[model samples]
Target: MINIWAIGMVIALIVTTIIVSIMGKRATANTADFYLAGRKVGFFTNASAICGDYFSAASFLGVAAAVYASGLDGAWFAAGFGAAFVPVVLFMASPIRRFGEYTIPDFLFARYGQSHRARIIGVVMVQLISIFYLAPQMVGAGTTWNVLVGQGLFGLSPYATGVWVVVLIMTLYVALGGMKGTTWNQLIQFWVLFTAMILVVIMGIVNGVGYSDSVAKNSEKPLLNPGKVTVAKLMEGEPGKRLYDVNQKNMTPEAFAKVQAVVDKGDPTAEVNILVPQKNKLHPERAMMFNEPGHRYSALDQFSMVLALVLGTAGLPHVMNRYYTNPSGKSARFTTVWVLGFVALFYMMSQYVGAIARQIIPPEVAKDPELMKLTVDGLLLKADQVMPVMGKIFAGEFGLGYVAAGAFAAMFSTIGGLLMASAASWGHDIYENYVNPHAEEWKRVLVGKIAVVGMATLSLLVGLGIPAAGLDKAYPALIAMMVTWAFSVSASAFVPTLLASIWWKKTTEKGALAGMFSGGFGAIFFIVMNILKETKAVAPDSFFATLGTLTFPVLITVPLSFAVIFIVSITDKKLPANVEQIWMRIHGTAAERRERRMQQMVLQPEQK
Candidate 1:
């Protein structure tokens, strides 16, 4: 059954993109205009656009899904995400803009005495972080498509169809309109996502599914505990294993048996849910509170997750590029303030939506014949589907379509920004600097467009392969988890180097290079090891498992990166000769730089 309403929303998105592209085309004639929107973005407009880029599908769908699946631990993800802006405002924003670079790599190259090595490393790190970040947005796109359209096209799976369509649309949006178009589109997207979440919350409350009621109902049910379960095959001598969850042991033996019997008859390779006794057992009938911890993370994991989110935000390449779009340092600071406010509002509503979802569609109802038929595989809602399921329940099909549009907006807005960042890095940092140092403005812009298309195609191919790679199954609510790895890499590879370069005049190019390689590779290595362990290629209790868990490798890699940079800089005495001049450029006021330039201009005739 085709959904006319959903199709209408997609058409609306297409029309809006065309109009924005036309407008952006008028202003996008030079590199500055294309990459930074002429550096004239207003405070609120930039702020809103930053929110759109920052939120992504992880914030739109993943945060709520995390909350629904993991209780309070999920809410912490939102908190860390929101809190990250504080460090940006305090440490990065003003100086980054004052330095006045086209991209993060641009800043690094300038600060390191115009080294091509710095530029190349910066581009590599940017692409690494951007690609990791881009994948989740693609996954979210696919998940949204499956729930909304629920159909395949030309023999492609719904997931593949979504990835292809979104990538195609966003590639055009970035390649045609450039940064100006992406910023304007993001401004509109943020509001759409914000309003959709607000409406869901309001409707949920009006329908007697408010926060308090949600908490009450959630507390009355035993939480599902996930682990490996061995199942006996009907055929003798055959055995199988699966990931399954059994509820708290508070349930009576008879009740437990009934649930187990149902599970025994189901597919042994699939996830199964059963009831058991509660851990506390003090009040067997009373359930755990909604705010309780230990649902998903151990104490150590919680701390690690928070650490990754807080530090990672500072290092994200796409986000850092947005700060460069500000007209001045003051404007950049103001943008961060506004981003904090916007992010806080979104997260608060998102968690409430997650809680409301639990109330509207409880775990017990997951097995109901009618509800089962409505889900992806005639089973419980996937973690990413929590928010959409709530939409379908609270509103009708139209509501589902509306929310689906909002979800796509979230993915498209972020993807556009990411593609633009990647293009700028490739065109300006690599091509202009290395391939054609004397390239004209038009030539540079052409190269950027080509880079945009290339990067988008690469990301699309990777996104389409996610389901086939079994990533969606291994990490059920993959948005947050996959995003965290990106964050981990960013924080480990870039944060220490970025902070040191900005604040430490002693930082040498060698130190920065060493730190970037060590930190970036370390994070990637651990993340891959963790994934292998997750897929059961390695033993859980092995030493490698200790380093490779879903919890970020940031804790190890970040400090190691910092230490490497500090030690290398002190040991290598070959600092940039113009350290004082660069310091003034980065730390001095904009007015000072302007005055210096004017004075230099005034003395030029005498010197000649």
Candidate 2:
């Protein structure tokens, strides 16, 4: 255990406390200020904050862990995550701001006219994504607390004490800081995160060369390509039966659930299991991580992550929400460019460290204390710990402490953004806009704080269920898996509307409403079907895998949404008639530049 590391973490917590206090003093009573930083943040500040908000524990720890386990396939996740932002920069940022809306609901209501069903469905989807997303952050904080504290400090279980303490601090921080406080915290945390990753990556590469040299001298086969192994489907515990075949058909949740009950009741005839291989060259225990083909290959190469990162960024709720913090639409765009540079620099370092960990950490350690022998278990050790473990290995005690500090910083920064987003949706959008339109600035701020705390509490409860789901075994993969849900929902719902609202002339209120419902409910159905298959009733992999793995399968949802809006708008016979002029502003950089020139023209006389 690294005692000094634990002490450093305590110091970081104290620093957070102080920063929250300062932010509270500076925060205004206005709900807008609380939710959107009073619409006056600078480009650099907003950029850093956006990076902080965007890079959750998933990015910090999850990506590196993926690369460590799955080799090149894991790199796609990091690339995809980063690339998702590009669409935001090119298409969504300025136009969404030009619409001048506070939340997604507000944007929809304003664009389509008041529609209760649309707002309700959109809100529910936001809540689902926020809550589900929050769990992993809590899990991450808990994992970091447990791993670092257990090694460095004296007492307390990691699961109980770590999660509680981390949540409490995060809740307080967001409650007091609001958007302004969160922005500052995220900015500072981004630097720390970037620094830690760079240091670790450099150290990792240096160590990698040394390890490779040693392995080259000792090994019979090349380190990159070991030995082959074969596999065939066979039922476990019952020798004669073959596993339930997924390749033959698509099974839904209801059928899967029935199959599960039958199996539980001791079916007279049943077959279950997929016979995957382990590497013949490695220890028998080491072979468990491979798929049926004796290698780890992710099926998610359909969209180049770089393209997703570039396009998906425009549509992400939390990231897009930060645009409201900027004083104007142009500042938001500038901030995005900054985020790209910062994130790119930081991820390079983390990826290097992941490569290093693959070489250094003994595959045996993954299974030293578990039923799952070393490899599968090794590949998935609480994804949150991948970076920290690398920190511990590379720099020893100091590295561990640095990693712990970085982890907590990353957790709080992300939680601050999520809590603020959740608060904005509930407090500013719903409570003030609908429930009490006449509420005072101070009252609105107070309500937002309350909502923030309440949401954090709810998320904490869900966080407890995460470990119970037996997901703790492979925490990183779970975190990455959960991210797909957020992506699916956001990409399905927000992307189409954002594009139509910005570009299309024929888009009408009815079209917007239809698009919203299609995107929102469609995502929900897919997710529910996937979750329902957990009982092993239907084919375990069919519906759920299809729902999750094809995040960008626009063929199913996008066209349906686009068509609904098109047909409905034409039937309604009411389009924004000045849509061409409006699109000139929405799609072109000319208007923004012209606005800049006009501002300069006015300021010239004042300066003289």
lDDT of each: 0.81, 0.63
Best candidate, lDDT? 1
- lDDT by residue (509-580, candidate 1, tens digit) is 999999999999999998898887766667889987776665578778999999999999999967888887
Model 2 regions more than 4 Å off: 113-120, 151-157, 208-301, 304-312, 363-380, 473-476, 531-555, 576-608
Candidate 1 displacement at residue 22 in angstroms: 2.8
TM-score, model 1 to reference:
0.89
Off by more than 4 A, model 1: 225-290, 363-371, 374-379, 598-608
Q: For candidate 1, what's the RMSD? A: 4.4
Report the error of model 1 at residue 95, Å: 0.7
Q: For model 2, state the Cα shift of residue 119 in Å.
A: 4.3
Worst 10 residues of 1 by lDDT: 234-243
- Report RMSD (Å) for each prediction in the order shown: 4.4, 9.3
